[model samples]
Target: MSALAAARAARAAGRVALTVPQLLAARAAKQPEHVAVTQGSGTLDLAAWQRRTQAVAAGLRAAGIRPGDRVALVYGARDWIAYAAAYTGVLAAGAVAVPLSTRNAAAELDFMLRHSGAAAVLHGPDGVVPAVPIPLVWDPAVVAALPDAEPLPGPGPADPAQILYTSGTTGRPKGVTAVHANLTHGCRLDPPLRRLAHSRQFLHAFPIGTNAGQTMLLNALDAHAGMLATARFAAAHFARLIATHQVGSVFVVPAMAIELLHSGALAEHDTSCVRLFGSTAAALPPAIAAGLAAALPQATIVNYYTSTEAAPTQTSMVFHPDRPGALGKATGGGELRILAVDGTPCPPDTVGEVWLRAAGAARSYHDDPDATRQVFRDGWTRMGDVGRLDADGYLYLADRESDVIKSGADKVSTVAVEAALHEHPDIADAAVLGLPDPVLGSVPAAVLVAARPLTLAEMRAFLTSRLAAHEQPSRLAHVTALPRNAGGKVVKHQLRALFDRPDQEGTP
Candidate 1:
């Protein structure tokens, strides 16, 4: 049988619990002595991890955490061990785990906590404690001192397991409710994730709170794998960890992969031990894809195109250097459809919205039935991505259905920041566009027609007072007139190309 057939067959195996804690319990029983999690100097075996998870559950229970309650997990990326224990403990207590991004400032953090209706929050070393109002805070020191916890009774398949938040572009972020069944049906896990479990070790580089980071943790646990923890992704130290730990896999965004390719450190490190290098969260340029393939000939460069609402929808494993725009075929996890604006299926290579459907697709966005109604339909999850599928079944991403600005790892909402900037009295009109940056990924370049002679520094100061750190513009360009087409809408694409030219100044 083919890979898709096998995935479908395994998915039909019936009623597997998909909760984070539940997966850990299953792994513990199946591979008790296997290495579960790791950092630079420490490692936790499955038994030890199970014990810690139990202890965390008990502690959470003692602190009055109940089932259906939302508990936030705010930690740095390298704290995967703590994340595993805390996440399972929350689930064991019959509560939902809502992971928080460490990069978020106090304002954004507070907003997300309140928006998610989070009753409790667990913070690692990097989180702001005073910003959250949850009753109990799960800290790293507490995790280290606590004794192992006992396994709690199962809630079966119907209980709520986790609530992953959508990328907050409009208003506040909506919680994506996921049941125990979603995990298994969403993505297929192979035996190599179990048989060569010890051989698999992940390098925690991305933000541990995002969907991508959560997927990495789930992937590692699925493989019964270990990890090398790091708080921040230093290109130098990250390369060192791969060589030292003999890490077999690493999950990086496309921008990071490109940066590593140009970092000059790829030649210095022995990265042959890395067998799987996964890239996601954005489109992979064919040229850059080829360069990475040439650099790491030993590793399989897998390109995954998905999102918070519909993840792992399509994957491209084989990269052909000759093809400029080739994203490999769809996986069994979801059905990919290129549809026209009227919801009609488009012809091959015709640009349209990439619609997806699978048994593992998210049911609805919690609390926002209207939004849930918009994105989720007759068993299909509209991925909000604009792309085309070729006759060969490979997808070619063109642009986004939503106006979310993706700069490297940062997903900035153009509407959100534009709203903030328009409030400034000195600013007459403001148009924000993403400029391609070689180092920090994508940076926002503001093209403004000020009411008077307003300096870029002055405009930035006004935004800094209101906007989050990453949302602020890295560069600002003063324009005499705003470029508008016949429709009166600003031509952001024209402004975007200005940042690409080396002729522009004030680029970071």
Candidate 2:
């Protein structure tokens, strides 16, 4: 057996229960003095972090939080340590955690608070206070004042852990309910500090409320080394942190990767310490992946594909020249398949709905049974994305099933068109959508942010070799930026609205 596989098996054999609080307690007991997480100038050792989280849990209990009650966490990225403590504290108190982004506006936050039936809110100083009728607003000071005490009994694996609200792209955001087992999947009772023995530090700039951010938090506890993160993402700042901290592993979304590549900050910093750079949230554009590989010759670039609902069922790929756009094969015991419209398996290279079944426990959307029924069926979850699997089982995503542009009779993938546009040196960002057309019923249109002026004809000429005539965009709009959500995904509905306006035309 492989050494890593053997180690994982050994660790799994020793595990009792897979719960966040138990994992934190295990790490603290095993590696009391190890630095767990660092944000800016502040750092916490495992022992201190555990004590603080327990104290926060006591505080929440004192404030009348009970088992199964939802507690909302609203914190900026810089306040991640507090956020982490509150997240664990909520779970430790046997209450469900509802992590909301500080990027959310008042109305959206209000809606989430009301929808989740949150009893209390734990917020950072800089977080926007929602106008909702939540009972308690606990901040850092309140948590600190609470006497340090052993928390209430840790929740069982089957108990609810957190409610993560999805980024509303197509419609209202749905809360994805995750159990303790779902959150703590793959955690093991192996030697606590063994995971990061060779690795220096793990770094990321994902905001506090994201799935990526929560994963990073888990890494902080379970990984072998210290964890570092920034509250706000600036490419130069992120680059500087990596150089300053000598981070060995880094995680980022594709947008952050693009910004860092263009910022020219890598040239100014000594980044030789970085060995692994990983991208998630969305597929790394093949051109961007190549650029990253060229820029960080010492590092291995990896791409991970998964959704909030179907996590731990990730498809991971280490970048290789032969598989330029492939999102590698499913790993970690997850199963992946492409299904046609008729719900049968699609042949290799045929675009169809992507479905994933996690190796661990299944998940469902909270309070939205209709949405749950639509995506989760039997043991599998529909990823709501359209893609194809290669003969070798590598995944290639086309576009979101809802975002696919229907032009005449041809179903054009917006992501494919955007990928082709991104291949052009002058285009910085791109979003493609289907616009209503009197003659064609619907025609593919593009909105782009470019480094230089571009004409529709120039774009079409460039894409002629890369795409078919029907796949080429029928109209184009130039904008300084494409609308993006907190998760860095393009809001294509907004793009469609922008392009459908009266003044906007086919030529830039």
lDDT of candidate model 1 versus the reference: 0.68
Off by over 4 Å in 1: 1-14, 130-132, 141-145, 169-172, 186-198, 361-363, 403-508
TM-score of 2: 0.94
Clash pairs detected, candidate 1: 18-180, 51-148, 54-149, 55-149, 67-94, 78-230, 193-223, 407-442, 408-442
Number of colliding residue pairs in each model: 9, 3
lDDT per model, in order?
Answer: 0.68, 0.83
Give all TM-scores, in the order shown. Answer: 0.75, 0.94
Best by TM-score: 2
